[model samples]
Structures are given as structure tokens and as C-alpha cells.
Target: MGVHGHAVGVDFGTSTSLVAARAGRLPVEVVPLGRTTRSFPSIAGFRGEQLLVGEDTDDLSGDAVIRSAKRAITQNLETLSVAGRRIPADEVITALLAEIGRRAEAVDQPLSMARDLRLGCPAMWDGAQRQRLLGLAEKAGFPIDETTLVDEPIAAGIAWVMNRSLFYGERLEGRLLVFDMGGGTLDIAVLDVLSDGPGTEPEISVLSALGAELAGDKLDQAIAGDLTSDLAAQGHSSSSARRPELFTALVLRAARDAKIALSQRAEHRIMLPSRQLGQLPMLTYTREKLEEAFRPQMDIAEALVWAALRASRLTVRDNRSAADLRVLTPEALRGDVDYVLLAGGMSRIPYVERRLGALFPGAQVFDNAGVQPDEAIVAGLADTISYRRLNLHRPGFDFIIEWEEGGQLRQEILYPAHTPFYSPQQVLSGQSDLGFARHDRDFPGPRSGSGRLRVRSTSGEYLGLAVDNQTMDGLVVRFGNRMDFKLYCDGRILIRDGSGRALHMRVDRWPVIRGRDSGRLQLRSAVDREPIVPTGWYMDKEYAPPIR
Candidate 1:
């Protein structure tokens, strides 16, 4: 195959995209298209009946180009218009993935035969959206079975940890926070990087994490609005413009450029045509004024960082006695944060680092050394995949138990993330309320019975959250005689309910894990079952099951 056996890491970012993997001793190179870097602008353009994707699509026409496709996932979108032509998001994604495969195959000859991939997406994607993306991947000839979906924050975290040397430290320790300001989203995560243990692989654990959809584009729009206002003051309006979309597009583009310039310079200038601004004027913007306009967006981002910290179990300190909690708890540490990491392209903003540094002066914050702040996520993706591959060859990390409290009985999750690919299937056991069944049409499904069980991963290394934190922490309840659901870090599940007590199952028997000697076991046995499943908020159950 190609270098290191063909596995690829796909960073499907909101603003830009990239694919990388371990090629050899040297780091994985970005799959380039002739002269560009590893990243491709995340955009798609439609012309007549054909679709143009990535960088070339970005150049087609601002009106035709669709940037930040990931943001559209959370919206209600059936079709997108490009030059009055309607196209589905799936079609756009299919075009992009096909282009990704084409460019990758051009560089790695082994990848020519390899259709399998490890794709990364935003953590905010829900169940339906994730399935839609998977469907798109399959329609483009890359099947879901051949791919593994990782969240962007998780992949970024992995990349950050692997490239730890770049941060200048004697192997990191204590709670570190990652303030990832990317194109379409802002994610904050808290981690505890432990010293290399005598018997374990150097471990990093997530203590807390959270994210907001607001990102660079929002700031761009904010500044663009300010710029537009200035132009309007000079008499530019949609009624007078030849093409309002074109004018708005130019203003937005200029806003993005100005934002980037402010990351380095104290002041910058923006030029506009006299015709666009009532014939008497050219427009100029200083970096200070732009930052002033964008301050609201930055405030939201800062709040999200502190909110993530408050969401952690670490925040639940023992209210009574200090001896009741672990010595390493934040309270024990006198509310001190130990480490702070910076990932994603937008993180390079000088103000971001400066503000975060002021918040936790005792903690160390990491920023990559490169001209393009945006390339770090993809580069980190490459480094993460490589390091995980290496760990697969060494002694793996230990697993911890996941326990949830119930009013009566406790529920438990026996397995956690990062369990080696070759590890045997793990098991979970818990007792549920064997209560009465009512013939109720109000049930979300046709099933007759319901039982809810809460489970959490106790794995030391999760994809998105810091090490030691469970990204897949939630409840799995089956009702109408049967209950089933698949859990994930993305917080999306495929559930099914059937006849009774246990509505539907992958296998017909208990102790259901089958060996290779048995006929192929049911894939859906783990979670997938029925359709028309209702999506809603599930309360985190924290009950401990009583010992029988």
C-alpha cells in the first residue's frame, strides 16, 4: 500500500477541508491540487447540471459558491440555490468527497485502492444529520462501514497532544483548556495531562467540554455590517447597486480580510469604489474599530469557555469535607487551571491568545507557529491519526467503570472509547423498574413498555472530550416492551422498540456477544433497530444500582 498502510484522516472543516495520514517517519503531507497547500476551501458551486467543488468552486462566482456547508446541517434546508439552480446538501457533499478522493489518490498510489477513511465532523451534528453525511459518503462510493466518524474537537485534541513538543514543556500535566475558534464553530475543552506513568501509555483525560456554533463567519458578518453602515452613511444602498448580492459579497470578503489583518497589525485599511458609496468617497477601516465592532462575538466565545469548565464533574466538589473528594480536584488545587491549548485556524488571532492568557495566567497556553492559522486543524488531524496508530502497536490504556445513579437501581456502562480495535466486545449490566405497562397512544412509538438506563464511557482517551472524560455519556431507554439505542460522542442515536420488556434486539439471546465461530452477528444489535424514532432531550440519570 502507500506509506503506513493507507489509512487516511479527513478533516472536514466548516471553512476549509484537508486529508492527511501517516506516510512515513516524516509527518503526513496535505493532499494538494497542483500548487495549493493541503487544505481546500470548504465550498461548492453549481453550473447548469454539473457541480464544481472545493477551491475551483470558490473561484466560480461568489453568488454560486457555497462556503461553510457544515453550518447548513443544523438549519432547515432541502435545497440550496446557486445562480437560481437548486441543489441538495447531500449532492454538494458527494461532490466534495469525490474531489477529496481524487486528490488523495493523485498523491498516494496505495490510496488508489483504498476507499476506507476516518472522517471528522463537528461535534454538534445530531443523529439525522450524521446519517445524512454518512449516506453522502456512501453515495460517493465511500461506505460507512469503511469509515469511522470522529468529532472535530476530538481530532483536534488528538493532534494537539501528539504535537506536544511544539508547545515547549517537560511533558504536560494538570488541567489544560483548548479554545478552538474555527470557521463555523467555537469549541472549548478542559483536559488533564498526566505524567508518563511507569506502566501506562502517557495519558491525557478530558475533565469538561462544550461548544457554540458561532465562529469566524459571525465575526465577519458583524464587521461587514459595520463596514456596510459606513458605506450606507456615504449613500450606498441595495436600491442603487447594480447587483446587491455582489456588493454584499465584496463587503463580506473585505471584512474577512480585515479580520485576518488585525490578528497581526495594529491598524489596517479597506478600500471601496466611489460609485458604491455615493460617488464622493473611498472607505477605510482601522483594526481597532473593527475589533470594537466584533467585541460582542468575542464576548460570547469567552463565556462559552468558562461555561465548559462549569459543566465538568470537577465542578461538583464535595460540599461537606475536603477528604471526601480527590486531592487533584480543582477545589484542592485552589480553583487553578493547569494547561490551556489553542487549536483551529482562528485561534491565531492575537487577541484570542492575549485574552485567554489573562484569564488563566498560571496555566500554559499553546499556539502553533505558522503563517496560516487555519491549517492547524488538518495538520493536527494527521498527527493525531499517526499517534493513535502508534499506540495500537504498544500497550493500551486501562479502562474504568461508568456508573449512573437511579432512584432505585444503578445502571452501568462497562466499556469506554479508545478500546483497541482488536479488543473483545465489552458488556454492561443494570436493573430497571419492572413497572406496569399502559396502552397509551402518546408513546413516541408503537412499543408498549419502557425502561431507561443511563450509561457513560470511562475510557481515559475519548475523541472529542479530554482524556479521562466520557464524550458518550447519556441514557439509553427502551419502551413499549422493547428499548434500544446506539450512543456516541456526537450525542446521536439510532433506536428501535419492539414487542415488550425488550422491544427489539440485534440477537435473540441474552449474553448476546457472539464469537467468529457463530454466523455473523447482528450489526444493529448494539443500537440500531426501528425507525420513526423521536428525538428529544434525555435527562442525565445519576443513580447507583443497589447490589442484589
Candidate 2:
């Protein structure tokens, strides 16, 4: 399917935000949200009920200004105090999004005409987080639903493929790794790309996606902390010691600007004015100093890359060892990756490019000439909408619920892979209930005691579940009586007993199970199924009886 009309993509970063649009068959263009730049700060402030966002917040100061509102969302903060008024974080984010929409409209690129809209998010975000952002987007007047959400790293891969096809007249087909280092998080994804002939859009399937809260923001804080120490050494700690919050914000912003400058130069100057200490002497921040502050985070990023590779089963380590160790030796893995795509503002660091190149020796590292690190995600998102790309796919592995019965371990296939989980009808009704089953028929008779109930993948890797806001690999519940298990289309698992005691958790991560025919799983449409029966017993209708 081709784009029916205009399509818009929004990449709401922690420190900044960007919007891109594609009209009919035209190329994707980044919509300028600022006066002179294509992107603007992801910030909001209030001056006595007068709201300000993006570039408007540039001259604002004090607690009224909220910086990194996206980070606040990640930390699950419900409300933020702005100008003596407590405002919901979602509303703050909605204002920023709405501002972007207004700016796009002012430039004759209104989102109202967009037939498709895609919002990019962190790959590791839970269902609740995605839903939160979707709701915010909807409130901001961009037509959106669950389907509108796209993982940021996966979007980067889509951008690479689209760039290769549209400009270079080449189709990208092979294992692609996306290293997206943004302001607040570093997201790594391994994808399998395949093109079907000349004019057709490429099919991209995500093999594994992982993320860590290690990126530009942390790097900025590290640099700022080092600068603070230097200032204290020079007898200039009055203002910072008094108005620490305000002082910290100023330094972090300076550090962030210096970090960007150091990307293209050998050194950057950091200067700050203080009413308490008067004007302080300017300090030179060298590239070496920036790299020194970035080393620890870079180490974490390398480990995260290896972790994503292991999750995708692209490495040579045994499955058991790969699953057990958090980090693996890079020497143990072969250079099977075809291309390494870099995205996000932090990816502009020369050290980052060199490090990734050394890590993936045989793979082609995309340089800035071929890709714009900061614009890739938004561009890719717009391309996904323009080309009607089919990248979102069903789970490649089955979900297993395990528990002990009669002194023996028993397991049931809670949700099977490649099955119809969602449909347009379900979306219209705003219901995602996939299946439900009674515990008596789905599990073996339990002994008269509390037993451990675990949820795992088909490969026996325990999946994390958040029960009542607490994440756990397994849950302990009394299992002598009748219980109910309900599975939702959004990876939510709900378990309830006859006594009305209920426990629920959303499965955020699934173990990758490679197919026998190929190492990659084919992309499947998310809305290809019919409206599933809400009360249907999935275990009885699909799989055999529980295994002991």
C-alpha cells in the first residue's frame, strides 16, 4: 500500500524534539519547529498560567521551566510542579506536541491532512509507557492509536533502508544493527532486512531490541560534575552551593552545548556568569576531557550492544551462556552483521563511531555523509508512513506460564506465536482482550499450599512481569482452588483467584526464538486477525493439555 496523502512522524526526544512529514510521493522533509533549527528543546514552562514550550522556554528560568519532560515520563512521575501549579506530566508533554503541530500547520504542513501518523519511542518502554505517549499524541490532535507507536531504533533501521532505496537505488538486505544514542537513553536493535524486487518496500523485522538509560544526559551530567569540581578548586562555589538546582541546570546546559561543539572541534569553551561570584574565568573543555567523561557510559553502551547481539542469536556463544551472562566478550562473536547504522545526536561523537567500527570490523559503518545522525529516526518514521511499510510483527516465540503442581513442574502455552492477536474491530472498540481460561482446566491440580508461578518464553528464559508496580520473574500464589488467567493483546497477563485476589503484569521483553528455515522471522501484520472472542479458552482451543 502506498501513502494515500500526507504522513507525519514525530520523534519526541528527551532533550529535543523533531517532526518530519512526507507528502504523497515526495521525499520526507523535517519540519522546522524552531526559528532557525529543524528541532527544538523538549521543554515546557509556565509564567503564571501562560504556558511556553520548545524555543519559547529558552529565556525562562527557575522551577517553572521543566526540562527533559520525556525523562520525567520515563521515570514514571505523575505530575510536575510548574509555576506553583501541579500539572500532570502527560499534559506538559501534550503541550509540547501541540506546539509542534501548530508550528507544522503554520508552515503549511499541518498534521490534519496526514493520513498516517507515527510516533517514535524507546524500544524498552513498557506497554503503559507507549500507551501514555499515544494518549498524549491523541490529545495533541494527531490521530493516533496503539498502532501509531514505533520503536525509535526500529525506525532508524527503516530510515536506512529507505535512504538506500530512494537515493542510492540499492536495496538493503541483511542483518542490520541500529545504534541509537539519544539524550536520555541508548537503544540498540538488531533487524533483518529483506527487499522484494525493485519497486516494493523492504520488509524489516526486528530480531532483538534492548535499551539502557545511558546516553547524552548522563554524559552531560558527568561533564558538568567534573566542571563543578574544577570551579570549587578555583574558589567559586557560592552560587552553586546556594542555588544548587538552578546552578546545576545551567551547568548541564552548558555542558551539553560544549559536548556538541567538541564533536566537530578539538576543544570547546565553557563559561558561566554568577551573580554571587561575578563572572568566572572561562574553562576550556577538550575532546580528550569529553571522551574521558564518556568512557564509562561507552563501556556500558558496548556491553549493551553485545547484549542485543546475544539476544538476537547473532553471536557464536552457546545459547545457555548467552542467556546467563549480562555481557559477553566481543571476540567471541563473528562479524556477521552487514551494516551498522548510527542515529541520535550523541552518535556524532567521533569516538563513538570509531568504537562501533572496531566492534563490528567487517560491517559497513554508515558515516554522516550517508546519514544524518539526529534526523534518522524522524525521517525513518515518515518513510514508514509514506511507504506503508510493514515492520511491526507478531511475537516470534510462545509465552509459557509455569507452576508447580503435585510436587512437579507444569507449564501451559499462554500465548502462541504467529497467531491472530489483534484486529481493526478490536481497535475500534478499544478492547485488546485476546483470550481467557479457567485455571482448573488449564493447569494440573495444585497441592494444598502456595506455589510459584513463572512466566517464560518457549526457550525457557524467564520473562519479567510487573505485578502491582513491582517487577518479578515469578509470583507465589495459593493454588488449591479455581483461578482465572487472561491474556491481552498488548502483552498484559492477568491472574485472579476465586477469592477475588488478582495479580497482573505486562510482559515487556520476550526471548527470541529463531526459525529453522532462516535465522530471521518474517514480518507479520499486527491487524491481520479477526476480532478474537474475549471469553475464549486459548489453551483448550489451540494447544494440547498442560505439560508436566
Task: Kindly list the per-residue Cα lDDT of model 1 for residues 88-166, writing each as its tens digit.
Answer: 7767877777777677767762333544356666554543565567677667655453125555665565565555533
lDDT of 2 at 6: 65
Strongest candidate by TM-score: 2
- Overall local distance difference test of candidate 2: 0.68
Residue 412, model 1, lDDT: 30
Score every model by TM-score: 0.67, 0.72
TM-score of predicted model 2? 0.72
Best by lDDT: 2
